[model samples]
Target: MEIQKNLIQLGQSFKTKEEAITFCGEQLVSGGYVTPDYVPAMLERNSELSVYMGNFIAIPHGTDAAKKEVLKTGITIVQVPRGVNFGDEEAPKIATVLFGIAGVGSEHLDLIQKISIFCADVDNVVKLADATTADEIADLLNSVEV
Candidate 1:
């Protein structure tokens, strides 16, 4: 599946994972992609999966809600000033969080997987976190091959 470049940017500039998810949900709602009721559920899911991987990175996501609608499946990237715990017992300075939300039985799993792989690289994660604009982040993502 061809990942939408705009969607990738939507996931990379949130102030925090929570903000990212909320903002993304709002965007989806405004864009007629999802219903407003789905936001709380998504937040709950994010809270449940918050995990901090050392070096300022956290991958937070929801459960089945992610796969509820193809249009709802999107990744949100958040940059925090002080960072959050992410439920990690040690090394929890995660300043950047990536939230992956998928629709039910999403056919875009490949795209999601590709994003996961791209984010696994510490250098890339750092670059994404440091990116100054959506276009910059898009450029960074474009440089990565699926």
Candidate 2:
């Protein structure tokens, strides 16, 4: 998956997970990755299962049913240094890095794996979260091994 520098947003703060997801979806939509309908699908998928990966990373993508909404394969990164709660207040799953994805065909699976492996290290996730500019995040994500 190619991480477009234009799609990356650094130092963002969201009040809610929904807001964060919405921003992610909008980024994808604006980038011509998916149709507007894909946004709601992303939210629904999140509601059904937590997209929050450990190590302060969250990968938000649409459901299988929304695959038709994909216009192209794209990835957008949103950095929230302050962190946003993806779980309930009691559980508290905070995500400092959000990866919004829209994939064509089966590319999403590989993309997810690549992202997972890259973010398995907390230091890598911190590099992304602490990114000062969009290019920094893009460079880091684009450097994903495999």
Candidate 3:
């Protein structure tokens, strides 16, 4: 799947996970990747379950049934420097970045694998979180070995 260049957002600082998640969905929606309903669906799932991936990243996606809300397979990433808490305040699963995926069917798995590879290395994850420009983040993500 081709990654849309406009979906990347770097140097973000969200106070809460909700805000971060909403921004991710908004980015995807603004990109015409998924419908507005897809945002709530993704948020609801996030509320019901933690979407945190290791290496300080969270991969958020809508429900499986919400695939119909997606216009095309796409991805939007937000690098949150301050990070966001995905668990209890005292023991939070803080994430340095959020990768919002608007995928159709099997493309979901592919996106996850690709993103996983991107974040597999601790240095790559740190680079992404600290990236000052969108182009830097996009270039790093685009270089994922998949």
Q: Which of the numbered candidates is closest to the native, going by highest lDDT?
A: 2
- lDDT per model, in order? 0.55, 0.90, 0.84
* Model 1 accuracy (lDDT, Cα): 0.55
lDDT of 3 by residue, 1-146 (tens): 55566887867888877778888889989998899999898888787887888789999988887889999888888878888888777888989888999887789789989888878898988988888888787777766633
The reply for model 1, stretches above 4 Å from the true place, is 1-20, 51-55, 59-61, 69-72, 88-93
Q: Candidate 2: which stretches are off by over 4 Å?
A: none
Encode model 2's per-residue lDDT on 1-146: one tens digit a residue. Answer: 56788998888999999999999999999999999999999999999998998889899999999999999999888999899999896899999999999889987788788999999999999888887988788778777642
Question: Pick by TM-score: which candidate is best?
Answer: 2
RMSD of 2: 1.1
Worst 10 residues of 1 by lDDT: 2-11
Range of the 10 consecutive residues with the lowest summed lDDT in candidate 3: 137-146
Q: Tens-digit lDDT track for model 1 on 43-115?
A: 8866675544445655444456544533545444444444444443563345564534444355345555666
Task: Please give the ranking of all candidate structures by TM-score, highest first, separated by commas.
Answer: 2, 3, 1
The lDDT ranking, best first, is 2, 3, 1
